[model samples]
Target: LLQGGDLSCVIRERQNSNKLFSEVQVLEWFIQLLLGVRYLHKRLVLHRDLKASNIFLKDGTLKIVVIVPGDFGVSRILLGALDFASTFTGTPHYMSPEVFTCSGYNSKSDIWSLGCVLYEICALDLAFDARSWVKLLMKIVHGPSPSLPESFSEELNHILHRMLNKDPMVRPSAAEILKLPYVAENVKVRSLFILTSL
Candidate 1:
């Protein structure tokens, strides 16, 4: 039998009653996750199942852990400069518009999912929910873009808006996202501190 540890346990422990992460906590999560995603995309990998349950926390830090074989079942590697992946992939709640409509998708698809995850981190709720996958897809494709809590900084709201844009081409790449003022500053400082400690 398969034996393993998973992030769900940690998430449950940290988010008792689904408590929201504070701004500082969310920023820390964002910078570290952005670094991880940037590494993946630079190598042409698409982490199709990037949800809270798929992530593990250790020493107050998080890692994108592939819990099982089928856990990353939908992930793909780009064979060219761009890919038009036509199959519907990823969980319905975090799936992008193109994936829902089967129009085709690329790495930017992950950007949409990241936006949803970012919203969840600060709000402690899924960005969109419904009774069934079909209804959920309908909401994802047709529903207005979800909003972050009013307490979130405007910088985060603007970044999430671009990430969740309906048009995949319009969404920022992982590298571009890391270069954003908010992410760059925080991640840079964190990396420097780590370097000094080494």
Candidate 2:
């Protein structure tokens, strides 16, 4: 069992204490999340509801040991490479614009949700929020894309932007994202660290 609670709880606690997570910590979690999502995608699984509440941390010695994406209740398995899931499901703030159009969405939709999760990790708040569902839909479908704070690195800013692109086809695949220099270095270091720890 995971002793540490979900990411939402961690973000809430940090917000309550007026302490934001450091860039390194956030990147560590982000890379791990990408790895987890990439693994799922490799098996043709789409985690429809990718949100902070669904990501759990395994902690040891008061530090985040592992980041695990849970809650597969709304997930779907694509039968083939060309298949897509057309159902409208997932948290509004994390849903992809294409999902809103009811046209159908694939792995790239999950990339969009990953972008939302990354934004929340950095901003400690929802990337797209509204008082009503209609307003939220409008904002997501037409409003300008949200951005990371000025303090974040340009590489991260670029990644977030690409992941949240209005066109799903433009978004990078999970493997492509992992290949980025910024993300690749982190993944390499993290892998070594895990290896040494074992």
Winner by TM-score: 2
Relative to the unseen true structure, what is the C-alpha lDDT of residue 155 in candidate 2, on a scale of 0 to 100? 93
Q: List residue ranges in candidate 2 displaced over 4 A.
A: 1-3, 60-72
Cα lDDT of model 1 by residue, 21-113, tens digit: 677778887777787888878877787778777766767777885433355477777787576677766777888988888888878888888
Off by over 4 Å in 1: 1-19, 66-72
Candidate 2, residues 46-116: lDDT per residue as tens digits?
A: 88888888887776212222222353367888898789999998889999999998989999999999899
Q: Tell me how many residue pairs clash in candidate 1.
A: 0
Model 1's alpha-carbon lDDT is 0.78
Task: Please tell me which predicted candidate would have the highest lDDT against the true structure.
Answer: 2
